[model samples]
Target: MKLLVTLMGVAFITLATQSQSIYSLNYTMGFGVGETSDFIGSPSFRGVTFEGRGFLDDQFSLGGYFSWSTFYEKLAGEKFTDGTATLTGTQYRYINAFPMLFQAHYYFGTDEYEPRAYLGAGAGAYKMIQRVDLGVWSIEENHWHFGLSPEVGIFYPVGMDSQLNVNLKYHYVFGVENSLNYSWFGLSVGFAWGD
Candidate 1:
């Protein structure tokens, strides 16, 4: 995880020194799906995204994307069966996920003053931490999985150098070993600025 962050920092600095680039900071809301929903059925309100894109042409761009999301739920007197043991108690469950990816995007209506729509995809790694607490006992697991994100969004110009950004994204993380796969949908609203 530390290595990935360091590499992304270096890449960001390198990209910033180059040609035209767009950067954004977004507030995100995530809804768990599949196995993720099976573990924590509640939607995640605690999330954020940071992205930087360097233009390769009028319609194509390459970027780096990073996001963090947390999902939590509490169940009272829930029965949990693990192996031959059956436990009934109040359980507190939590999932924290960080996704870092390299992204590519294609834009439409770049020359127009109206909103520009885009299709983008990203591939990279996801760090997931899952925890459950039952009374005095707690079980936690951490895993790293390869992930992909596909999104559709629009950039609405708000000023000379800034735009209002909105996007809907889906994240899919493949399982590792015997681990379970995870998936989610995210809606984001933010501001973007660039040359």
Candidate 2:
């Protein structure tokens, strides 16, 4: 978590010094896949993303991306087993994930007045906090996992200095030790500003 923060800070500073840069704040919706779905099947509407990108040229840019997503579910009178131990009760399960990544993107068009399509990918660390509550007792664990996200998006110019941005991104976080891998698809809608 510390490393992720430090890297994001440095990336932001570097982007701020660039002559041409863009910043965006997005509302994100997430759908869990595979093991993530098995744990929390509900779609997550509580998510947000912030990004800063420095243009290297007309078609390419490098950036820092940070996002938070929360998934939760309540199961009544469920059985849970861990090793030789077993518990039966109402379970409230939750997952909070933070992903901080360095990203690179390539734009397909150079026209300033028209919409531009882009392809991008990010790679870095994911901090996951998972918890389960049974009555008054709770079990919690935190882990840092390596992750990657591949994205496709469009930028529609809405004004001289602003654009409407929409994106579809997929996140994959690798498992560590005894933890299970997590995956999700995210749809983001936002506005971008800058040169």
Number of the predicted model whose TM-score against the real structure is largest: 2
For each candidate in turn, the TM-score is 0.91, 0.92
> TM-score of model 1 relative to the true fold?
0.91
Clashing pairs in 2: none
Off by over 4 Å in 1: 1-10, 81-85
Tens digits of per-residue lDDT for model 1 on 114-177? 7899999988879988899989999988898888899999999898889999999999999887
Q: Which ten contiguous residues of candidate 1 have the minimum total lDDT?
A: 9-18
